[model samples]
Target: MRHLSPGELIDAAEGHAAARATAHTEACEACRRQVASLREALAALRDVPDDEPSPLAWDLLAARIGRAVREAGAPKPWWAAWGWRFAPLLMVAVLAATAGVGVTLWHQRAASGSAASAGAVPGADEALAQDADGDERAAEDPSWSLVSDLSAGISLDDAADVGGLPPLGGSERALWQLSSDERRTLASILEAELAESAAAAPIIPGV
Candidate 1:
């Protein structure tokens, strides 16, 4: 007796040719056993439900895909679109701050310069007054020729001393010794000298 092949048994179990295979299985013991095995395998396969996705699962998948597509197509915000809009404003703010700082520094520098010039004024004025007095004395006296005498015997130490007075000490001392009028005059001369000196002095960069 010829036994049914496993493939034929499987086809028979699936009811592909139910009547003909049923007859073959009942007559042949080997074919009957093969059919039974095939039937068991088919029963196992049937026990597992079909893996086709449910309608709810399909909707969830569609929603996720739709969200991804929408995100990909969405336009950027206005700020992102025109990022350079604030750049000029930022630059202006920076420049304004810098200018304010520069103006403040300039005013402070001017005030400092004014103070320094004020301090130096008296000494310069006293020196000028002494020179003028020497000139006047020389002019009035034939015996005391100011230019020749100043050129001949006057050293820096002697020149530093004016009139019948002792050497002018520091600015403070000179100012202390002078009358109010003399002090004022000395102050003006010192101011002028300081202005000249400030003009002549080369500016040192970066305090």
Candidate 2:
């Protein structure tokens, strides 16, 4: 016959075994010894009183529990984890928005200043428009038409005479004798001076 299990021995020792287990313990010497040992151990445990903690031990336990509960290990919100993932993108977007606002404000200020300047000067826009048109026309026509009053003493034929003019100055003759590279460099310098003068000159509406 197989030996009685620990559960069967426990049940027999506690007076709660089935009839078969009780009969097995009765017939088996080893099962009877096991049941007796288990009964004695259970009786010894029952004799001992339940332990209650001392006041200091209770206080220490409570403090340890409180420390754990009040600890600074606060978990981050659900969005906080995702925020780090997009931090660079968020920063870039913020910078782009700031730059856009700055540029828009700068343009608005520039336009307001231009409007104020135009308002302070009467016919300023018209004068500028006229000057631009005159420059375009001058560029298209290389020839200058003589005014009757300005050319009072000279005929059209005499105006065309090259010998009537004064001889070239030292600087003028030197410019005419410049090599191709030197001429290009000199032309660039003259163009720069002309541009500076044109920028500095004030526009007169009728002139």
Candidate 3:
């Protein structure tokens, strides 16, 4: 009960059957049925009318396929899709970072200036003690007297306003013209005095 292969049956359906194949299909019911089915299917396909595409339809289809292929193959630009949307956010971030750095630098410089002023303050006090010609000049400026009073415990509010010293705004030229060593001494003394004050001050609980 050996049967012909499907390939042999298809060949027979196409009318290209070998003599042996034809004989086998004729003798075998299964082979003959398979061959008949293939023949009928093939005949139906052949009988169906060929649909010819119009020129415009082919052109449009080709254009769409070509566009799709080009889009898929082309490398996409990062900025093109997202740059405009995120550029402002990036700029704002950069600005914020720059401002923060600037503020930090300003604080550092102000601290250095304050430390320098604190050092210079004691020299001005010494100037007040000395019978120098600058005494009359120092007395002339209203701001000079405040520096002397800071040595005597004045309000912290006043110190904050004066920036840890009286407003030495180029009024008394001698006060401005302190030597480096004198400034260093003034700063050290001021630091020691401040430490003593902090030690003496009463601490409030739950602060």
Candidate 4:
């Protein structure tokens, strides 16, 4: 049978696998190794403590807050504040700013989509490839393309000729030159393979 995957091993390590899987893992040496690795990782995670704030830290924070309260001058009435009177104006200004930003973004998006549909804009992939090429040239480091003219100067006709090569060219080239003894050995090997396959799956008939 095939070995258990990492996720299956993790579940086994955690003692969360089904009965059948657990049985198989118990017998399988490969799965035992996988489970051991996963358990080691789990152990490492378990060793890291969940950090909590100390009481001394809380006390220091409370002391700072109490000192700030004591130092503040005379308290004023909440309703008499200028901020309360201008609250509506502040809200109107914020809303206007948000609406202006939304409208600008929407118009820009519409323009971009129209340009894309008209095929006026270069594709994302094309732009990325161009940018990469530009960066490579600017860096002045010889790229795979520059170091090997293996592909650089190849014309379309040359490419087509290469692509259209006979798939069995090597076999065809060697087939015609084989000696009689070499042909006999190849035939014997084929016969042996066929015999083994047939013997392994012999037909059984019943009355």
Which candidate model has the greater TM-score, 1 or 3?
Answer: 3
lDDT of 3 by residue, 1-207 (tens): 668887787789999998999899889888889998998999999999989888799889999999999988875454433434334544543444454334434543456567578884333334323323434644553444444443345465654543343332222343334554554455456557856998878798455
On a 0 to 100 scale, what is the lDDT of residue 149 in model 3? 48
Give the C-alpha lDDT of model 4.
0.54
| lDDT of the candidates, in the order given | 0.54, 0.55, 0.58, 0.54
Worst 10 residues of 4 by lDDT: 164-173
How many residue pairs clash in model 4? 0
Can you write out model 2's per-residue Cα lDDT over 32-88, one digit (the tens) per residue?
999999999999999999797786998899999889977946756534544454355
Pairs in steric clash, model 3: 119-187
lDDT over C-alpha atoms for residue 202 of model 3: 75
lDDT of 3: 0.58
Model 4, span 72-122: residue lDDT tens? 755555433433443453344344445433443454445547768998863
TM-score for each predicted model, relative to the true structure: 0.27, 0.31, 0.31, 0.28
The better candidate by lDDT, 2 or 4, is: 2
Instruction: Identify the runs in model 4 with alpha carbons over 4 angstroms from their true place.
Output: 56-207
Native RMSD of candidate 4 (Å): 33.8
Return the TM-score for candidate 1, rounded to 2 decimals: 0.27
Whole-model lDDT, model 2: 0.55
lDDT of 1 by residue, 1-207 (tens): 556666778778777846666778889888877777878987998899988987799899999999998987876654433334334433443444454334434544455567568884224333334333433432454332322343354354533332232322223223334554664464466567867998988799553
Ranking by lDDT: 3, 2, 4, 1
